[model samples]
Target chain A: MAEPRPAILIVEDEPEIRRFLRTAFGVEGYRVVESATGRRGSIDAGTHKPDLAIVDLALPDVDGIEVIRRIREWSPMPIIVLSARVQERSKIEALDAGANDYVTKPFGIGELLARVRAALRHAVRSPSGTSILRFGNTVVDLEKRTALRDEEEIRLTPIEFRLLAMLAKQLGMVVTHRHLLTVVWGPTHEKDTHYLRIYMKQLRDKLEIDPVRPRHLLTETGVGYRLVLDE
Target chain B: MVSIDKQRKPPAHPFSKIPAIFMGNLQRSWATVLRMNLKRHWVGYAWAVGAAAACTFVGLVMYPRFDLVNVAMVYLLAVVIIALRFSRGPAIAASVLFVAAFDFVFVPPRGTFTVDDIQYLLTFAIMLSVGLIISRLVKSVRRQAAAQAALEIEAETERIRSTLLASISHDLRTPLAVMAGASSSLAESGERLSAAERHALAKSVFDQAQEMSEHVAKVLQMTRLETGAIKVDRDWASLSEIVGAVLARLGERMAAHRVIVELPDDLPLVRVDATLIEQALGNLLENAAKHTPPATVVRVCAQRRGEEVIVTVQDYSAGLSDRDLERVFAKFHRGSVEGAGAGMGLGLAICRAIVRLHGGQTWAERVPGGGTAFRFTLPLEEAPSAPLELASN
Candidate 1:
């Protein structure tokens, strides 16, 4: 028998959103489970054990946060939060509560699917087992701690290399400011977030095709950074 | 001697102890006091009577060791106490009673209203006059205290009113200015601008208009809250669902930040006005997103402790200073955070109002790990036997 398509669970309160997401994910050949309430969502998450789950922060019966907490208790399955534009707190809560990624509501289907795929890939792959990270024409050799773009050596400062490597370590997942600051500048300098921004700008200037509007080295405002590896 | 004889005619009635002019003035003042609203001061009059009776009893007990003059001073002390504690009418009544008690009880011929010595008449006049003067002084002091209180209250109201006006104008002008500038640019540069440039300008206009509408909505909501027009419509709601709906509404705007929600699965249903609470939560989230740098984590977590559900929104930005945290909920009080958006600063104020209306307390604190955390608590009664469901659209 052909390998079973990965099961994905969607817990959104709105019927229209549930329908829209169902259609969008269905076309991508993943089996989808729908739950309209947070209560039902948690129950479905427990029963289905889907490879990935997309939860809405607002729910009629229970909060999407509850669903995230419940799933996180037992499973490491990637949970992608679907939220509204104003729910920055809920988005961060979902992320810190073990949600792997999030897509804000009214999101383009292309972007949602892209995040879903990234989350699912992160779930399936081991961390940095493969020594190389590539996005656009840039190649980062993790083992050698060296980077090349368009076949030319890209000189990166020590701080830039550490920042880039930290993001590359996660590949597609978000790395929080606290985590980055602690790792790069040590625990005492965690409050010095400006250092991260300055170095991130430098990294983008060197690595991105357009530094002004970076694609691969993305900054998640008020959160941290995520490095997108284009297939 | 003939001119002096005409003036001396007034002194013919030597038996009249008070001059005619003084007697006439006293009568006129008494008439004015009688015409005043005595019924409104009935309680003060009663208190004065009670005080006079108590003083008379004390004078009777102390008359053995203390001289008659000392006992009279006790009556004077009672008059002063009544004057300070009661209205002007009561004070006047107390003064009259003090003189009567002193003459009837303490004067020689102790139990009778007769005075054998004509010199004692002078003592009675002095005591009565002093009592009246003390009453007047006490009344003036009370009036001054009340006037000062009124002035302070008026000043406070004026300060708030002007602050509101300034904040509304500035907030309204910002978006209005943006809209006008963007639209005018499109109008003036249509021929020279490329299609993309035109689209961008148009987009900016639309965004500013949307922002202005949101501001107007906040302002209106605040007014309604201040006017006591909003009634809390308490219903059992799923915390997660309300949070989810807010997230859905704020969808694209929160795209950059990583949002984490950590509500427990077994959290009991909370009685709250869902719409208002949702708006409050939305404001907090928007505030966090606006104030923090891109990609910083914003977290929402709720814990059930006893009968309260404590919900917190935490952000890992440069944490708010102690001063900012204290004033964050004051209307139009914006933080001094750099790169913070041009908000009218009503978000936190509105959140506080909404939460307080729900009988909850809201507060902001620095997160231990480097960010600001806003927390609010809702009192929870009993969880519904069945899980509360969101109303279907």
Candidate 2:
């Protein structure tokens, strides 16, 4: 008997984005169903019973958070939201309405995949979800506060790991400047997005090739940051 | 200063101002003036006939006591009435009639149409000339006084509006800015909580505060815009740099839409007030966000066309109708029914005033597909005023 492949449903308004998510998730060996509007997207979630859903917070007729809430009335699947408004309010609403994490637009393929994986892990764990994640030659064990790169232990400060875990939990999605700052450096650090400029360089140097042009850590200029998990 | 009131200035013609402004217990129009003149003609003609009959009766009776004093008084009354009621053409005719009456009944030959005394002839000519001068003076002074009063009223009203706006500025903006800053800080502090708790706290504080801030900005901008007293220091600045500054300043707003910058890197510099242009662009971008759907692309681009650098901000939202495109730049003329209510419409109006101050132009048009494009221009770089020395020097 074969193991069931965790299905990821993508809800987006643009054809380019829907196609992008469908192809990306399909390549990763997860069954992917794409819907172009919030209503159909929410319906697909209920009917398909996807293990995880990637939702765009901006839709033509409805806000993605409302869709997340309606589905959450019944299903407990983890939802990862994509948004252009990197403002904190929208992100919080999507999550509180049952989305597992949030991503800002113009994201990398790998960052989205990682978020999908992390969200699935979160769905499996339910509330108070925390987990271990591995990508490329690195391993992150959030429960133990440790990380290893290629079997060699890589040191991560409590704050650095908190930032890493923040990205890890929203893997395959964009983690906005305010969100990362709020999670690691506290609210005072929200507008201090320049702080991310300094810390992100640290994360890439520790985990990527040619840290100057990082693959796993990407910047969505004027939006936020995305963590791509593909090697 | 722009008056907060909407009263328009009456036209330059004094006749136009007379109806509304006349210490006017009278609703006077040109037609009314004409009607009154026609109505007075019947009484005037009867009085003239009566006076002619009275002079002939005294002459025919040969009353020696009826001297020049009695004849002069009767003729003078006719001159005054014609000058006041009828026009210049009619007044001259009345003067002629006065001279005939004196010559026939009191000049010399009693009841005869002949001037018997040379002394009486000079007296009659002198009275006619004086009557003409008096009529002309009355006409000129009335028109001049009407115009002078209208100008005084406009100036006085402007002074009052400026004083009121100045006082409102200090009272309104200071408190609004303080509340906005404090609310944002509260929202940002939602960190260090469990995932659910953190999200909840951030949503409430950030959203309510944002709404209040948008409203405050519109009121402040309007009050400031109305003054026409923005002190903008202009110099040679690059369009690319201006766009970058505008985008950077609208950090919060740009977060909601995909803003694509398509300005060429090598575009020429333009003489402009960098701060004001940035502020204007900030308003335009904010306007776009309010109208355009979330995630629809908003673009800012610039190019040198015919010695002018054209800068345009285009949004892929519902385009405006013909009426909206026409008055989009008008003061406080907001897109009321077409879009969701946000801030008061002062954005494009500010943009227009800014561009015109630069001695350039601004306009808007509906894009073919489904969006509104706001386009404006700045003059291309002029030869540097400083004496240019060769680099070899």
- Displacement of the residue B180 alpha carbon in candidate 2, Å: 12
Per-candidate TM-score against the hidden true structure: 0.56, 0.39
- Least lDDT summed over 10 consecutive residues: which range in candidate 1 chain A? A192-201
Model 2 pairs whose backbones collide: A110-A228, A111-A172, A111-A227, A111-A228, A112-A172, A113-A172, A114-A171, A114-A172, A115-A171, A115-A172
How would the docking of model 1 be graded? incorrect
Over B1-393, each residue of candidate 1 has an lDDT whose tens digit, in order, gives 433544767555665434565665686886666766476788888887888889899999998998877877787777777766776677778877777777788777878889877876776676667667777888798889999999999999899889888877877888799889988998898879999999899788767766777887788888889999787756545566567657766777788999888877666667776678888998999998988878989998889988899989999978888899998888888887545364888898999999999889999999777999999999988653421111211
Point to the candidate with the largest lDDT: 1
Candidate 2 lDDT, A117-202, residue by residue in tens? 76676566555434576657888788897789988898766666777778766665556666787877787756554456545655
lDDT of 1 at B374: 92
RMSD of each: 20.8, 22.1
lDDT of 2 by residue, B95-176 (tens): 7776777677576676798876677777677658756876797778877898989889988778655644653454445545
**TM of chain B vs. native, candidate 2:** 0.54
Per-candidate Cα lDDT values, in order, are 0.78, 0.68
lDDT of 2 at B5: 20
